[model samples]
Target: MKRTSSLAIRTASAALTALLALSATACGGSGAPKSRSGGPVWAEGQGATEAVGFMRVQTPAGAAEMKGAVQHGFQDTTYLLSFAASTGDAEAFVADLRPEEALRANIPRDSTTYTTITPWSHLGLPEPETQQKVRTASVCPPCIKDERRSAVQSITIFVQDIGDGRARVYLKAF
Candidate 1:
């Protein structure tokens, strides 16, 4: 009867929809992951607005400049922020950070070279072309010794003594 045909058609349509969904998933998705945005975003500013918008922190005393940029990959997002302040401010900034274990465990206690950041690293912050002195630290709840990884969140800190009683702080979070 018409009732049985209608029931059969409804069942067939449901099964077809389920099959198509499974097939799409098994084939590595339509294109991009569903959990993230469809495209990458990048931006930079001369002061703390952009950086602070992405992070939670007070502008340090004598903050000369700050920049924040983000790169959203197919499955991951990276945020970069930097600021220039007095040496005392830099030290305080480093001390104010919590859970420095990941940085402590990282090798090369310190360095005199600028942390290598390219367009891919910082979306192009104008770092001084020369090295002075740099102190580094990082935070990643899921990171382990010899292997750096991110879980829900991650942060990497770099404080460079650009001399003249000023230090530049760079932060990377994802």
Candidate 2:
């Protein structure tokens, strides 16, 4: 009887250990989905790092006209500036942008702007390989001194071709 009780206790302990392990994995161990190449996939609105000033991409001279609008997020303090451009000029506009151009054209006069231009992929975001053509850049502005306000100083820009003589430009700032 003593040996049987000991074996039963051991079996129960083993089952409990297995249950705990499975529970932990089900709760938080699994992470974001991975691509076929074993790289993490950057899902829509999932991977964004902080940036401040907009990337400086020059519009090609005499390219098709462009229109823009600013959109505010409903659930967050994020802001996005969307631009629609002629497909012919979209690639050239993105290519002509200097990596470290000042963002005076988009940011407020008093806002601090960084001179460094970093690729979005460097911030743990996967390249937009699925898009027809895409370019992304980011800048982090200087931090605000006020204690009462929470300022998001990171900005990222994406320029992507959407086909049919149209390209979309997205500037996401948080």
Candidate 3:
């Protein structure tokens, strides 16, 4: 009887230990989706780190025409940009972007202009390979500091390559 009781107690204690461990692990695990206001939210493994080309504006001389139309009180022109990265570098690219807090803190005191970011797409172009190559993406519209002034910046990104463990980021700004 003594031996049996001891064995029963040991068994129960072991079961309780296992249950506690499992509960703790489950409570500490990550299982929920992440999101940010209206901006794009990056997952754990979005974008690459291989330094795709930088984002910049296209020269006016190169433009086929004077691009831009009135939108939200400003004449915004579409810019062309490009990026290239290895199939696995997408996560790093997205991580390198400025976070929401950083952007808010960096807003220029005199630069009261607001910009909206959205993905740009046109006919014949395939969607960004966020899940496979690009990892993450977003868009930002160029706005003027004052309604009376013309646009002071361009807004457009063009992805052109994703090979040789590198990437390119081109911008077409007017």
Candidate 4:
């Protein structure tokens, strides 16, 4: 009886080991798959080309505001912008700007596929303080490999109301 019980225990242990191995394999193991683009998974969709153009045209006032808000050294950086304005005006500006394709309106993860917009916080960046509200948008352009890609590659924009109709806008690209 003792020998039989020992054998049963070993058999159960082996079964458990096998089950764990199988589960890991079925779950794709650990770590994300290597990406060729090296950009975030969210960076794989139609970019913000039209949106940027629209911002440039519609928010000339915001652009002027950006002149003061942009850090001096970072001004030459591509796909980065900052501005300050009234909260209502800033919200309206963001609302008016639309991406050519539908953007996912949530934070994305490593497993996130192409064609989605994750929140700014997902990038592990510090969130700015706001008195009233904060808004953000993420875009991963679809034509990442296209030569004529005009949109911001992988960008996130944050708009926050500082109070008294004043707001701050910040854009970052990955």
Q: Candidate 2 — what's its lDDT?
A: 0.46
Candidate 1 residues 1-174, lDDT tens each?
999999999999999999988887876689344564455555434234644555455668678777667666555666667888998987776665554553332234233454543342343554433334655677654553313233336667777777899988877766
Clashing pairs in 4: 45-141, 45-142, 46-141, 46-142, 47-141, 87-165
Number of the top TM-score candidate:
1
Per-candidate clash tally? 0, 8, 32, 6
Task: Compose the digit string of candidate 4's lDDT tens values, residues 59-90.
Answer: 53644344212111222323334567877766
lDDT of each: 0.61, 0.46, 0.34, 0.49
Residue 18 in candidate 2, Cα distance off native in Å: 7.7
**Which parts of model 1 have CA positions greater than 4 angstroms off?**
1-48, 102-132, 141-152
TM-score result, candidate 3: 0.24
Q: Write candidate 3's Cα lDDT for 68-94 as tens digits.
A: 211121233333333444423433433
Local error of candidate 3 at residue 26 (angstroms): 62
Question: How well does candidate 4 match the true structure, expressed as C-alpha RMSD?
Answer: 11.4
Alpha-carbon deviation at 80 in model 3, angstroms: 2.7
Pairs of colliding residues, candidate 1 = none
Clashes of 1: 0
Sorted by lDDT (best first), the order is: 1, 4, 2, 3
Ranking by TM-score: 1, 4, 2, 3
lDDT of 2 by residue, 1-174 (tens): 999999999999999998987877766666334334423322344321211122223445554323322223433345444455786665555444332443223321221332222223233332232343665665554342322223545555576666787766655555
